[model samples]
Target: MDEVPGVPAGLLGGHPRVLAAAAATGRLPGRAALDDYRAAGARAAESGVPLRVLVETALVMAESMDPVPLPALRRAVSALMEGYENAQRLALRQEEVARREFVDDLLQGRADRLAERAEHFGLRLAETYAVAVARPAVPLDDGSVRDGTVRDGGGVVRDGGGVVWDGDGPARRIEEAMVARFGSHNVLVAVRDGGLVCVVPGSLTVATGEFTHHVRQMFAPGWRVGLGRPHRGPGGVVTSYREATGAIELGDRLDLRAPVLKAADLLVFPVLLRDRAAIEDLVTTVLSPLREARGGPEPLLGTLEAVFASQGNQTAAARRLGVSTRAVTYRLERIRRLTGFSPDDPTQRFTLETAVLGARLLEWPAHAPG
Candidate 1:
């Protein structure tokens, strides 16, 4: 009749039996529980060994007697309680460390493993997976931290929902939540310096109108996030990661909301972003009046856009605008006379086309007929 069936410690000593006795019956060993402790001892003598023996040893080892010897029994009990608390805390700290080491080992093995896992994850998801760039909400020495990454080293994205929700310590909770939303089990999160990486599945890769709100909620105090286009497998994952990084970098360079630039912008030059300045003058001076409907020149701004898009090809421009070719020529001549841009010149045409797009962004006045 050992106090606890699963544990056997009686061979070591009687002291351990006290802990085993208390643990077995779910009661602190009073004189009554001591009977169980004794029974555990008896069982140990008969069987190979009983758990109570070692448990008793542990209990005794944990005991610290006060030299003064005032109320020694009470003091001993208090010391035992303290030891239990300490043991619990230490165990928790050790477990946390162990988990971290586990993750590190997984990361060190080779990206190939993660790649393989991510591919399976991607297939399981059967949906387009996107890599989001998470930046710190606040600025850092090298670059800004992406959102939530500081709070939760890795975030799991949910389907149709932004990963803005705080996940408990599981670290994979956010991903699990996404699993619920997207209806897939293939999801993984990898954390790297400066960002959190995620693998998702599905066909359309970009965060849609549905995800925008969640992105802000997922945002943390010190980090920001920019989502990358959805990609497939390793190539897609890498592409999305690069895009997310680019978005963060580009966002950092531009004032918030100057615009959300995409990965394609990486190939563009600084001059091109500012080059829109060249078209500002033409738009403000010539196209402004044309856009005015009440007592303004006939609305030829549409005409202007079509003409520019066509590279000044009057026939093509006419077809595009649903106007006759002759009508297209008249509008082209009208534009040249009003704005000093001769549609025949290829260079002038290029400038006008670029200007139109830039003008829309710069918030310049409409084209006014000269």
Candidate 2:
């Protein structure tokens, strides 16, 4: 009997029926060889051989024997393909378990060797990266709940409700989409903190508006995304992740409904919210008159934002507000009389803008305590 190169002798030595069948038919035995091929498939999977290589090896071994009937050879190849596919699925499941463990450790701050661990998963940690977090706009049905936790790309564990969004469907879609755009190795999407989190390469200089538009179009209408500023290194990934979560939290608190919120644009409110007493004081002292205005605080606040956004240009601000320039001037005059701060002066304009920002952050007049 001819020996198969690179295969251990013991593998075939113990399977005499397989050898006899091969000798007689010049092809692997049907049904009889299934057990032997299954063993071979398991070993191939363990050795990390590609399924293509395993299929090729099976064909080569079958052809090496004296001429076998075409029908018999075809049957043998189909059986080998089935065995290889089964083994491949098993191998993939095992790999996913290991990858999830590594990702969990990395996110929990337990993995000290970031570069080494990242490389093991075919990731490059040296490049600039940003984290994006997404949550569903609608709640999932209770029946869809499987375990207390669901492992998507990465895993997330939550308290209270004891449920976190699996994000399996959307997270896979996100990873596939980003990979298609940026290449397979450039993006990583995981499920964390009841949402999908993606680590994408490139600096903030990359047009976030364009990226946000793409995400909004690609994802389902129910998804809301938040992006962090780009930073370098594996450790910086944690910082970026925190920034992404903060953006989502702040956006929800302030009721900003843009499809994607950028952490860079929300830098001030989060810090100001940390000093709640100061924010309250600013609302009380500088914004009290506007709160007591005849038409309510929203109209004046809207005008202030428009004026500031237009850089004190009454004509431009009026255009944006869909009002006449004289109306814009009247609003600014009312603001000056009520708050004792003139919008015409750059210095007072700065203070008034700061106070308005504080009021919005605190949701003053609407939710302020009496």
Candidate 3:
């Protein structure tokens, strides 16, 4: 690059190599915009565009009309500047293409590797991940993501940026940056969508509880998240993704705090059904009538557990039963009325607590032994 004549000696800029270096790599930090610049340069180089054109343009832009003013030379400089403009526009378009292609390749290569890493780290890729998609602060269409920010793992679930995400602070910050980039409100950052997903390893620890808590705080209003049931593998992500989406919709309908759903939560109903067999018939039928007819009759289940637990201490039993001394007396009188046993008697408290536990488990209605 030549110095423009009559321009101050210190005003030395427009070195093509310097521009290349600045645009091609980083001296400080970088933005996504910088990536475009680099991509453009790479395309220009690969397309066999002559670097001489770029270099010559820099020389023309650097020249100043000082002591020697030539009209033809000035025209040449103007033509060169215009050429630079065209070159820059070409570079920008090429950079955009390069970015899309790069994102495609990056996502493709990284998915399986993420699966492998999750396995090595004891995160089951088969286990469902909570997909939380986000984009820039701008509104993106449903299932949209910015290039380089989210890599598509295919079919509505994108595996997270495993290695790329490691030292970049917590994944939440990455989501926040994406939001800023897209200039969007709380956008769903999912695979192919504004989905920000967490591969919640199937293993449930106390920390998983904490994970759920954090998941709830991840978004603001007008954004939705779908937490899928724990799936078996990456393929399972599709189903899990569907489940979480359904859950978010359901939560919206039902006014739930967190829209994420877990497969295990559904098992509670089944377990309750199965346990009822042991509870209903074991003790309630055998003891209900006797307790009601006793002279020292009490609510047999409550009194029995208390007395047996207290080992016949009237005071302690009364405290455990949440009753006053006089109430305890009245109830105790009713207890002996039917069961032919006094709670004051030591041997009887044993049978009483056993019966109490049985009745409690059965969820049987209370009775005063006659």
Q: Who wins the lDDT comparison? A: 2
In the order shown, the candidates' Cα RMSDs to the true structure are 14.0, 6.5, 15.9
Candidate 3: which stretches are off by over 4 Å?
1-219, 259-370
RMSD over all Cα atoms, model 2: 6.5
TM-score of each: 0.38, 0.67, 0.30
Tens digit of per-residue lDDT, candidate 2, span 1-370: 4655555444334344454466675774666667666676667666666667666655665554555445555665566566666666555544544655666665555766767878766677777778777776643221123565443333342323444433344455655666677665666655454576677775534534434555576555867778888877776777777888788877776656576788999888778878888878877888788866888988898898888888888899899889999998988888889999987888888888888887777777777746
Cα distance off (Å), candidate 3, residue 20: 20
lDDT of each: 0.48, 0.67, 0.43
Q: CA shift at 197, candidate 2, in angstroms?
A: 3.2
- Which is superior by TM-score, 1 or 3? 1
User: Which RMSD does model 3 reach against the true structure?
Assistant: 15.9
Query: Sorted by TM-score, highest first, which candidate order results?
Result: 2, 1, 3
Better of 1 and 2 by lDDT: 2
Best by TM-score: 2
Runs of candidate 1 with Cα error greater than 4 angstroms are: 1-16, 20-111, 114-128, 139-176, 179-184, 204-212, 220-224, 254-370
lDDT of model 1 at position 28 = 54
Model 2, C-alpha of 316: deviation from truth (Å): 4.7
